[model samples]
Target: MPLMRPRMATARLTPSRRPHPVTAAGAKPAAASTMGGTLRALSLLAVLAAAILATGCSTAQIEQLKHSRTGIASGERVVILARQHHSTHEAELDFVECVGNALSRGANGLEIASHSDFVNGLYPWFEPAIAPLNPEELPALLARPGVAERLAETGVRYVVWMDGMTERVDGGGSLSCAAGPGGAGCFGLAWWETDARYEAAVWDLKHVDQAGLISADVTGRSVIPAVIVPLPFISRPQANACRGLAQQLQEFLVVEDQLTR
Candidate 1:
């Protein structure tokens, strides 16, 4: 028999195996869990957006009454002063300044006298002890010696007396914090509402009459949500009240057509 050639050993391979589904019966629970987590994240984001929208906002209701027609000439001056005679709290200095600056701005704005300077210039007369509380008391104050002459010399034509203050009228929320050996932190949410009430009486020194009366009531909501540090969402009720009152006041003094009766 012919010599048989040495047979070489060789490894054999079957056909390639197809990829199996990753989320099969054994992994289906994990896939569902991942989807659930994503949905929860989206819902939390929406709630936060809504909360931000609801906080740090202010609203105002303004009213005006015309006692008599009023207008100011270029040479005339108006001064804003806070009334101390009111039984309730008096208007804040910043609020008074805000209104005065607003009225003195713009091309159509009126000439505004310095609050401190005007009060000081008419010192002793406009002292807190004897300052006129309303337009009716103006005549008596003006009748004092040298008062009339001093006012005329300064070209002071109008007087705006403001009274009121801001208060925290309502709030409802709870917050708690705790400390541990591992760490110290604060966690919780709180909210509060503020109300700002302000009113101004306009008097005409030249005519010795009440020109107009304007008042503003503003309410605002603020919230603070904390995880580790408190995040305050402050609403500016006083500032909003001042801006609204000033805009209405400027229009009130311009003497357009007739006036709001």
Candidate 2:
């Protein structure tokens, strides 16, 4: 997604068409006035940033398909993995992290193993060049010496292989800003649309079979209308997708009959 892109330079307002020559006393006030103007401009930018973060609209839908029975017992944990080896469809790091965090929150949240530590423990096996892309490859991977033992130590019940990314699908509108000696202001309006489509395959390591598939699709439109200060009504589909996916993933793994503290 494109972030707020604005290039602004420090500018100040001077005495309006002064007919008299500038004196030392007058020069001091102009300098002070310039400093005050810069501070105000900075304050406005801070407000804009807050506005952009606080105001956004997003739509999300989630689907879950169970391939086989799936649930996690007590003391078991889950690991979130992404398809970094893929060329164009690889999931981004931020989305992966966001999902992991979301899954680990709330009172009934699931346990999550440390992603960095788990990957490091497997080392070369989980590396991009050698990583197993799907559950079918797991048997061969475990047959490798030391791979099964190392994986067993993590007590991971499922491995979620995340695939997909957020894309800028469509956009329109124009916005422009200019700065000069008189001060600076922005005008015009710009808008863009982004779609986040992500799907994760839950691999049941304990059973060495596929558990279920969860998919999240979200669409959003972000707009910036600049009259004086650019007011951004940013839409974040990625965040919404992450949240929805994580919730569904949690529900998919926890059985109501078997709740563990």
Candidate 3:
């Protein structure tokens, strides 16, 4: 029997175009005005780019993000999908395991599969130079004989698609200066800190089983902050974050049971 996709929700989340940083202070008023104008221009360009990219894609590939899948029906089999852009395969696999572990501990009626055999839909959204796979090419890949049969052998069902990000950590240091009686007693005190933060952004969610594709249900994106610790801190704090976020997502689905499939 063909799996039924979840009903589409009325609420949709449009991507934000807000700039991460505001114009630097200490600039002249005129310069600030110019900067604001530049920011606005960039924002418009971004909107246009998104519109173009979204024009021809299907609902699943475009607006229906389907990131975090929670509140699934009882006994629904589940599979985790992990992808990365410009990051090591090791990193991607680590994230997949983290997700699987979290779900296994908390979620019921779910099963974990091998990370090595997980889905890698080569969709266009992925940055080509770094991680070369396009989602558009997924159907063909799936059709390449024996794919679904193999997945059925594993008893795979739902998919939890994850995207990981790696950014350069900017180490920070602060200096202290004070005034004294005779001469200014200014001392440079450096406090070192790492600005590197890792986070997983859930980009796609789909419920696929041995029966076949289900209707695209939830659509939206979610973020889980990664952990970057100094020497004495835990190496991968992101695991806890992932578990927390997953639990939160599960709660969200429970609340929206009426709205989601």
Candidate 4:
């Protein structure tokens, strides 16, 4: 009886509470939402970077060009010529014409002689000799007797030599061509990329030295798909090159203020 009086009641133990599975599941969705937002932000940044790159020139060389508030003189005459070589193609001639026309319009009254006029009209006899002159031989050609005199007679103060070509840099996918009662046609899924590269050497005939060198390069890609019907897209790399070269020539020949005026 005495020992039983000292017996004390034992306290009941309770289990600790834990997080609900539903609550854990809810937290997962919130984490996923945050991750989704981060991914979207990253994607947006990539698109913006690509857009900036696409709008501007892929490759440009303008450091050799002179930056002046007062550009070429109004009465000074300029001629655009194509460097002759085995690699020289007809596109260079077109580029020359494009640059000449652009300079004529933007050079603030400077005389821009057409390539044909210089070749066909001024010194037709020397065309064969001068047409083959490379960049290195330009100085020697200018020093030759009657060469400088002829250019002077025509009033050509600056001679710009354009040389380069546009070529398919990369191509992939499959293309197949076939002929039948319908007609000859090509069908496939294909894509190709091209690069247009050219350099302009501006020679100061009056000073007998190179004034500047302007190089421009443009790259473009196109895709063609055919499933019974064919659809082809034009990359127009040469056209892009022409526009870029002409614009650069314009900027080189004219000052910013002159263009606005």
Query: In terms of lDDT, which candidate is strongest?
Result: 2
| Model 2 worst lDDT window (10 residues) | 1-10
Across residues 1-261, which tens digit of lDDT does each residue of candidate 3 receive?
A: 212343333323233322122311222242334445767445434433443333212112111222333354444445555554444632345655665676666534245555545444323222334432443444554565676566556454444455543232323333345555644322222222211122233212233222111122222221111111011111222443354445443443333333333
| C-alpha lDDT of all candidate models, in order | 0.72, 0.74, 0.36, 0.57
- Candidate 2 global CA lDDT score: 0.74
Measured by TM-score, how close is model 4 to the native structure?
0.59
**Across residues 82-140, which tens digit of lDDT does each residue of candidate 4 receive?**
76654446346666777677667742545787677777654643364545353456677
Candidate order by TM-score, decreasing, is 1, 2, 4, 3
Candidate with the larger lDDT of 2 and 3: 2
The C-alpha TM-scores of every prediction are: 0.76, 0.73, 0.41, 0.59
Q: Which ten-residue region of model 1 has the weakest summed lDDT?
A: 10-19
| Cα lDDT tens digits for candidate 2, 1-261 | 112121112112122222123332343354346546767556545544443443344456677666665677889899998878877778998999999999999866899988788899999888888888777898998899998899989988798889999999988878899899888767666878899999988898887877778888887767665545556666678987888898888887885332222
Task: Give candidates' CA RMSD values in order.
Answer: 26.8, 13.6, 15.4, 25.9
> Candidate 2: where are CA atoms >4 Å away?
1-57, 180-183, 256-261
lDDT of 1 at 184: 57
Model 1 TM-score, 2 decimals: 0.76
Compare the candidates by TM-score and give the number of the best one.
1
- Reference-based lDDT, residue 81, model 3: 54
Count of backbone collisions within predicted model 3: 8
